[model samples]
Target: KWTWSAVFTLQWLGLSIAWLDGAEVLYTYYYPTHIVLVGVTVSLIWRYYGR
Candidate 1:
């Protein structure tokens, strides 16, 4: 969870920076996919490690 939080924080920061720089279209378009992929990856990792 902590690791995911950190990754998410950095992701948001980077997205904001890029958005301000005018790359809003790409990020907005892929945001959902990006989030889903991250969530799945983290959950899989956590499950594996937890075992």
Candidate 2:
């Protein structure tokens, strides 16, 4: 849905900006990023199959 897509896109853009700003070591963002990724995946699956 739009909410999930927006969350994913915003997170991706934030990460990309951070990396471009010389934040080569993004160790702190791994857990949050994984959480967002999993959330998006689960949201898609539930939307389609949990009907």
Candidate 3:
């Protein structure tokens, strides 16, 4: 739920950016960066929110 909303927002943002810019940015930066960010965010959520 928590990460869902954040990730969802990022999904749209990334989509918009990719649509506005081009495939270069989407593949070069957005893919790697978004993957790392999602990993980190999920890790943090697990570390702090887990029982």
Considering every candidate listed, which one attains the maximal lDDT?
3
The candidates, ranked best first by lDDT, are: 3, 1, 2
- TM-score ranking from best candidate downward: 3, 1, 2
Candidate number that wins on lDDT, 1 or 2: 1
Q: Where's the lowest-lDDT run of ten residues in candidate 1? A: 25-34
Q: Stretches of candidate 1 above 4 Å error? A: 24-51
Off by over 4 Å in 3: 1-4
TM-score (C-alpha, index-matched) for candidate 2: 0.46
- For model 1, which pairs clash? none
Local accuracy of candidate 3 as per-residue lDDT tens digits, 2-36? 66897889878997898789988889878897888
lDDT of 2 by residue, 1-51 (tens): 786787678778867766766555355664467677778778888898888
Cα lDDT tens digits, model 1, 1-51, are 786787778778767766776767547654765687688877989898999
Give TM per candidate. 0.48, 0.46, 0.68
